[model samples]
Target: MSKDFYSILGVEKTASDDEIKKAYRKLAHKHHPDKEGGDEAKFKEINGAYQTLSDKQKRQQYDQFGQTFEGANAGGAGGFNFDFGQSNAGGSGSGFEDLFSDLFSQTGFGGSASSQEKVGSDVAVDVEITFEEMALGTEKKVELYKRVLCDKCEGTGAKDKNTKTCETCGGAGKVHKTMRSMFGAIQQVVPCEKCHGKGQIPKEKCSKCGGDGVVRDYQKVNIKIPAGIEDGQTIRATGHGEIPIGGGHAGNLFITIHIKPDQNFKRSGDDIVSKVKISFSQAALGDKIDVGTIEGVIKMKIVAGTQSGDIFKIRNKGINREDRFGRGSHLVEIQVRTPENLSRDQKRLVKKLQEAGL
Candidate 1:
């Protein structure tokens, strides 16, 4: 009886390659033998299903003939020569090797041997920018005291550029091992311990970094903050963190943005809000008044009988919108101020107006 690969992986027949890979990863992690309550049989089953569906040509063949395709390649599921004494998890030698390779490339699955190579650690830093700077994009230069690639060996970790390929794994950076499990013998590919998966070793280690290919030093990194970036938003600076030892990809630098509060303006989504004080006369009659905005102070009209807390908008003067082509509006709130002290003549005029019911 042919195995249903799609059903085993819990994916539809029309599932995309990413969806299949994701399903396989989830199932593989859940059923791994090394973990508590892990099922070796189920892990093997998931690997087999992933092995058949991940390949384009093999998937087409399986869709057409299940596992009984005529003249199917020896490396595929249809041509497996089952040995009851051995693990039936793989069709041929290549299937298990391919499975390990694919799994290792995607994520780390811990084992007796190294499943992943050592990489540099990620670094995070907090950056403070003014509210005006957040409104308009700006760049900041931050000094980081961390590991950087060695200058003497240029990250090769060698003396006078002297190096040789690792003999244990034959420069492949990985080696194959067979282990007995509940299901039977399973072959796995693991990182070579001799060269630490670097594939090469320095004949004489670099004096400055002691073969690590990195040194702790101070470096200034420039981080660009996008326009209208919110507080607590993070910006990733790729390849700017710690450089790996013995030469690998560098890790990333994460910059968290902190905006300084503005005394005159407050942020509300894409718009900015500000309050402007107007005298009672100005509120009672229509007049033009200067209002504060993010760009600058601009003239705004105050209509007759304008009440306190009335809002007016100044278009295109708020934060810059990076996603689209435009700026947000600036909202101005009116505060009407009553006269505190009145002269005798002013009191007499008010008294006369009050008498007339003005």
Candidate 2:
């Protein structure tokens, strides 16, 4: 049957192979007979189009020869069919059933892999940063001892960089197993344990990776700490984790930041809170004095009649706002110092004032 594969999938002719595959996956999921209001005929048509358009040579032939060309190419794939919903339930459908089975096993929706390549394990480490470091963005390098791609063999897992097809599963890299489950005897296509899902085998294995394509080694990873990052927040470093055995993607590195508390200053949101001690004379007479802050020391006015424990604000003296929308002020709580012992002259002056009041 002739079909406008692009129109059926609703993609432009200029779309890339990825776009075509993505469109096919979307339509296939929508029309799958298992879901409510599913349509079998429409599902078949979509699947048929994808089957022909996904392959490079076949796609090229179809694009040049017209829609009818797909039928000839899809002869094998079309002959094989299993009910999408029921193939797993209890049916022993043959041919394309196993193909569909493996396709569904991919991650997410359209995670295409010739042989299900596994993702590596993630690495996590806690890093401590000073309070000042939090205010200012900084970068840190962490020491890690973990699996990495083999430099000697370039992760080919072959000693001589050559391999023959695994004897167990041939070049298919999968073994069909008959197992008993709730449904009954279901034929399952699993990765060949011997070849580890690589269709071909290297003639010689790389000694460093032991044919697994990775080795446990030391690495120094550099991570960036953005300004205003809160304590105990984790930063994810992509592809910094362990190496996959079959030459796939590396996992991620998670960095948990711990901010060390500063005794002289406390952070309240974006604002810096602190306390300052002023002499009784300074507080009473309203003198200007230097107050220590994150932005060095700045002169602050001690207002006249400033009482103990009174809070004063110094504008733009706190942590700089991350958004660059001005800055937070330093909230300084004032503490007035009182002398415990008075000198004879001080006592006489105090007595004269008391007597005058009396």
Per model, state how many residue pairs clash: 0, 12
Show model 2 residue runs off by greater than 4 Å.
1-115, 172-192, 321-324, 347-358
What is the TM-score (0 to 1) of candidate 2? 0.66
Q: Score residue 155 of candidate 2 by CA lDDT.
A: 75
Give Cα-based local distance difference scores for all models.
0.76, 0.73
Residue 179, candidate 1: alpha-carbon lDDT: 52
Tell me model 1's lDDT, rounded to 2 decimals. 0.76
TM-score result, candidate 1? 0.71
lDDT of 1 by residue, 1-358 (tens): 6458899999999998778877887798788877789887687677667767876677898899886753353344322322222232233332345445553443322232233465567899999999989887899999998889899999878898788998997786766666554555555666676776778888899999898888999999988788899999999998898876666666789999999998998899888889999998888887999887777778888889999999998899988878867888898999999777999998897788789996
The collision pairs in model 1 are none
lDDT, candidate 2, residue 98? 45
TM-scores of the candidates are: 0.71, 0.66
lDDT of 2 by residue, 1-358 (tens): 4559888898887778778767876787788766688776787777667666665666788889876686575545323222223323343332333455543464411144343555677899999998877776689999999989888878778886777888887776766665443223334566666776667666777877878878999999999888677899999999899886756578889999999999888887777788899887788789998888887888888889899999888877766656778877789989999755989998887688579992
